[model samples]
Target: MILLGERQILKVVRFATIGAYLGDEDDQVLLPKKYVPSTLCIDDEIDVFIYRDSKDRLVATTEKPKLTLGTIALLKVSQITDIGAFMDWGLEKDLLLPFREQTIKVEEGNEYMVGLYIDKSDRLCATMHTYEILSGESPYDVDDMVEGMIYSIKKDVGIFVAVDRRYHGMLPISEALRIYKRGDMIKARVVEKDEEGKLKLSLRLKPLEQIDKDSYTILKEIEKQGGFLALNDSSEPDEIRKQLSMSKKSFKKGLGRLLREEKVELKEDGISLKKL
Candidate 1:
């Protein structure tokens, strides 16, 4: 059977004006002349990725698309037509992004994260609505370091992530140390599994590692501010958060490390670089 949206090693059975008809016994797909290997001949096998063309006809190409069936990726909008937008998926035929599949208003020359799916018409198309298509279960376990793309951010909720572009994961606001926007690929550690089996993620480094990083940051800030900064353990939580983008608890922990190492001297009003 011919597999659409997949690469298959098909045998060349016959020739045509446009290309060579490649298949086994029961099925054949056209391998366009441009994609036909110069040394290819009848009964010889060649690898080709198959998909429907603009006319919805089954066609084969030597070029591989960035995304395939049941896969999600960040694709660029190549053009916009009356029917829908076309995404350049590194294939001869731009993948279709129909109006109904668009989650937001898309325009030409911008990139959008989308998923590929076969529609009721048995044609492959791209859709911006990917959350529903992402799987909730994953093979990853707690504390496993994983990477994912940020899909959506919600106020007071968290940033929704599509792990491996398939599994569902989220990085909560409390764990976010820096600002992250949609479409950014981030590396995070799995903190726990949610009720639905989706992953709860943490972008912060491991405790000891974070302390080391924070200590370095505090020392650098103090030096940058003329060898002293008006920030100390007694500083307001909001002020610490505003300056460091970290919780007061974390700032205190980092400050303690710096003080213990004699790297900085803490005073009533601020901290200063220790003179060696």
Candidate 2:
């Protein structure tokens, strides 16, 4: 049986003004006239990708799609409709990225990595949930520096990464210097490999102590809030996370460092930067 979203070599069965019909007559698809080779004849086998056109008719094209079924690629958004965003995937018909399949809000002209899959309707579509399609068997080992794109972010959980756009990796939230958004490029070191060989990533440029990193985050936040913050060790855990997006334990570590260094002053209600 022929498959959609895949390249197949089909035999030319007959010709018509519209184009050549490929495959057995009982189950043939059209290769538009523009794509038909002038010298092509019946019984000739040609490679093409099969997909439904704008009119929802099965068609064959010599044009190679950038992404195929079960594979992921960085596709550009060509247009947006109420149904979904259409992405340019090197085909005449843009692939739909249904709103339900989006991991983040997509905008036109921006490129995002997506996996191709046939939806419930059997039409080819793109999905930002690429974790289900990426492989964990990467060619990376511990301490290897690799670049990845943030495909999904779970608060208090790690950011799901697509390593080099093909492998699975995770950048734990505790290791993050700050909050990250989906589709952002990340550079990290492979700290460990999971049982499945997926990478555990660390954002630290060097293997510095986690406390020092945590302290840096607090310091930055204090500075960002104009030399003071309305939270401290006494603040509720929820309040700490509300303001810092970090656990109270981590915040205290950062706060303790700043106090020991005389970088800030703790008060009854808040902490203030130590003004020189």
User: How big is the RMSD of model 2?
Assistant: 9.6
**Number of the top TM-score candidate:** 1
lDDT of 2 by residue, 65-173 (tens): 9888766777899999999999999987888999999988999999987998887888888998887888878899998899987877887688888887678999887
Q: Where's the lowest-lDDT run of ten residues in candidate 2?
A: 202-211
Best by lDDT: 1
- Candidate 1: 10-residue stretch with minimal lDDT: 173-182
lDDT of 1 by residue, 62-97 (tens): 998888765678899999999999999998789889
Each prediction's TM-score versus the true structure: 0.77, 0.54
Candidate 2: TM-score?
A: 0.54
